[model samples]
Target: MIITFITAPILGRLLHPSDFGLIATSAPIIGFVTMIQNLGLTQAIIQRRTITKGQTNTLFWLSLLLSLTFATGLFVLAPSLARYFQEPRLIAVIWVGAALTVVSVIGEQPMALLTRNLRFRLLAVIDIIGIIVGAALGVAIAWYTRSYWALLVPLACTRFLNLIVAAFAARWFPGRPVWDEAARQMIGFGAGLSMFNILNFLARSADNLMIAKAHGSVALGFYDRAYRLMLLPLTQATWPLSRIMTPILSRLQGDPEEYRITYISSVSLLMLAVQPGLLCAVIYSDATVALLLGSKWAEAAPMFACLGFAGLHQTFTSTTGWLFISQGRMRDLSIVGLVSSTSTIASFAVGLPWGPLGVAVSYVISDYALRLPFIWYMTGRAGYVGVGDIYRTVGPHACGLLMSASALVLIKASLHAPSLIELGGILAVTYAINSAILIMFRSKRRLILQVLKVACRSVMLHRTSRKGRF
Candidate 1:
């Protein structure tokens, strides 16, 4: 995951943002289909108290049945659906993607075992290996062919590899499917999560479709790149947090109060550090885009600036959805989906006329303005996480970000940056200075000091460990 995160800049430098945009356009349709394949069985396994081998086999067979059904439907509809998007070549692409159905059938039980055991280190390693291989393939193919298909197929192929490896890695072998009673208990949970995933795709994909329809694929490409960049910070925080905190949250599950406290603390720490990193990226949007992507994606710089504010909004609310899931308050999650999708669809309806730029603006408003309030309510009422809890965690970071933003703008404007290298340095320095001032003035002097102490300790420990024998 870390390597993939770091490799993005290299990718941005190599491929056209439009290439990414084109592939992103496929995601909604593909994900919509994938949602159907799961039928909630996988998630049901995770959230269940116990999943027997026989029941797991039943779920696996059911998943395989769904996969073949969906694949057949996909193959038959592929050309028409491609034409619907006005990219008829997509039919062949979708045909190839349909193979995942067969490949993933063997994966459900082993994957469930891994999840049941909470062995995410193996999971992460598998993820990283797949990405490393896929990214290498993507870069090589893009550099050689410069075709959008290169990006599209590599994504599907990597998942196929992961399913194959992870299936065997967990040492679970497949057997005949048998109907089981335990499987029935999991149906509702799976259905709800599947529905949520579908709508979530629509909410996100609506923006891409609108942008593509109004602004064209070239512009949507730039918009997609910006959105991807915006998400890097979330990925950074969530990837690790999901691994570490979920177990902790699971242990504290019997006590809502403790779970709530730990949840809020985890979110707070994630937001506090990620805010400045994203702020720097936003401030240096032009430089960063230019440095990584060169002149070809100059349009993406403004797009990055446009979508960057979404990062701040996400910092507070991203994990709230998980909170709703953890406590079985999925009604809140459904509400979140309903409201966010409605807001985004409505915003896209109103904003598409203005093209990609308008889409970016509406995204920020719909996400922060409409969706956040509901998330706040959900987390507060269901998770028992208080309003003050959020205020305490996010308030200082918000202030620091605001300060950093102001300094960044001034520094960028003042320097008349001629290169990405210069702009990155200026943004980093200004953000640090601004953050320092904010930290000193904020009443959370104790928290600030604690972070400093940890930083110093980490450095000393690293040095000491290096100097001593392994």
Candidate 2:
């Protein structure tokens, strides 16, 4: 993650916005195809309470077959998609992405097995190593080659390396295929989840697709960067929690009260982890874009801020997956996904004429207006958790978000400080105010302090272990 944060600006400055835009434009096809390819069967592997070796093997073979089929479709469709986007160069990009998908699905079962067995340390190492190496490789290639292939090649290599590493780390192998009633059940679960993911992929990629088509690649480049900037909290914090939470939540499913309590508590900690960052991004959107992607992306500033506002809503709503998947409520999740996707696509259409900033603003409005309420209501209906529980979990962070936003605004307007100094002052005030408010919340305060202590002890133990080894 640190490597990615550091390298994004360097790549942004080195590569054209068109380059990123091209990637963004071509991404939806891959996203949609991959969702189909997986059939969400892999997640079913993790979600199910018990699975026979035969069921696992059957799913594995099914996954491999679908992956091959989709890779071929992508490779064949590359030219037409490129023509549609009016970026002929996208042909190669799509082709490379096709190969990458084949490599990616190869790891699905092993990785899923690792998740099922709770081998998170190995998963963490696999993820960190794959991304760091991939980012470094992408930066180096882009520096020298100045080509979009730089991005594509590194991505392929990353997945390739991840497959190799995960295979070894997981130490699990699939045997002969066995299709049975259990396989049918697993596929049914996976197909439902796949439906949800298909909607999710459309929601995620529709904005980028429309921006690229209507406004062209340059506009897409800015919007894409802005959107990614907004999603940093989701990627860095909330998404990871969803992974850890789903499996843990699945375990707690039999105990409704415990599951409810745990879900609420986890969401609280997730907000604690991500809310301040979202606040900072919303407050410092321009500075952040300037600092991270360089001044060349100044067009993305307004869009970034708008998207940052959406991030607050996203921080809470993205966690709905935990409740849905853990509770085996994929049908409900799929319905929510349909509504969310429809709302997002409509926002893109409404916002298209005004450009990326308009799209960004519309996204925030749609999220809060449509997606948030839908998710809150749907998850409540699906699980033991309810709307009041969500309010109790998220309300404090929502207040803290408002407080942080106000502090930053006051610092900018009243103090009239310079950019760097003003940002520092805003951050300090936001931190102080939010910290005070959190300390007043005894439960949240305890969780924060507990996490800090665990981190400190882990560091101390590492140091002592090193000394003893010496």
Candidate 3:
């Protein structure tokens, strides 16, 4: 995340909007294909409590075979995809992406093993190294080529590095596949998850697809960048939490009350971490765009604000998957996916002709007015989590965000900051004040302090151990 944040702006300046759009156009297709390629077996491996060497070996071979097939298919279909997106360069861009799928296959089983064993620190190190290396490569490529391929080659290289790192870190070797009843059961579970992933991807990408088709590449470029900016911080934060929580929750599955408590606490902490930042984005979209991507991207500011609002609900609701997968509720999760995908698609269609901002605004409206409420009701029905519980968990953060927004509005109305830096400072002060108010609440205060203590101790221990080793 740090690497990307530091380098993305430089890449943005080097590359054109069309360059971003061209790559963005291919993402939905690649995402949909990768879902099929993995067939959700990775999640299956992580969710399962016990597995034999033979069972894992079988899944590993299955993953490799599927990945090879998908890579070939994607490569063959590159021309058609390029034609559809109407960008000839996409043929090369997509071929590179296909190579990434192949690279990912090498790490699939290793990643699952590492996750199952809860070696997250090692996983984090592997990922950080991959991302850092990839970011550097991407910036260099953009500097030299100034082409859409610059966006793709880095991803492929990153996957390749990640595969090598994860294999070494996992310390696991694959044996020959044994196709038996155990493999069948795991594949059956994964098939259900695969379907859910497909629907989920469609739900997430429908807007991108629609924007690309209706608004054209340049328009899509603006929307895509806005969407990327909105999602990056939220995803960087929540995705890691999801990785940690899924296994932990799966381990606690037998204890229903503990599961509920864990979910509520985990999600509450997520909201506390993300909502204020999103609100800050919402209140200061123009400055964010100016500072992050330059004034050339001011056109995306409104869309970014809308997506920022949607990201809040998305951040809260994304944890639903952790709960569902942890509990082996794939069928239930699939149903939720169906409803979510359908509603989101319909919303995208309704907003299509109006352009990118319209699509973004509609998405936010649909999330609040339809999708989130329905999801809360559905996920809560199992008695482990109640809709009231979700409301209670997120309510304080929502209140804090509202207060922060209100304060920001008053500040903007009363004073002109004269520059983006001063404006940022003013917003920072507003957030600090709001944070202090929230900390006045004893429970939030305790949670914040506990988190700080844990973080500090971890850093200190890491330093002490390094010194001892040296």
How displaced is residue 85 in candidate 2, in Å? Answer: 1.4
Candidate No. with top TM-score: 2
Tens-place lDDT per residue, model 1, 60-123, is 8778888888889889988887776677666776776677655765565577678667888888
User: Sort by lDDT, best first: what order?
Assistant: 3, 2, 1
Off by over 4 Å in 3: 415-420, 440-442, 452-470
- Model 2 residue 220 distance off true place after TM-score fit, in angstroms: 0.5
lDDT of 3 by residue, 284-315 (tens): 78877777787788899999999898887788
lDDT of each: 0.72, 0.82, 0.83
Clash counts per candidate, in order, are 1, 0, 0
Q: Which candidate, 1 or 3, has the higher TM-score?
A: 3
- After aligning candidate 1 to the native by TM-score, how far in Å is the CA of 311 from where it should be? 1.8
TM-score of each: 0.88, 0.95, 0.94
The 10-residue segment with the lowest total lDDT in model 1? 438-447
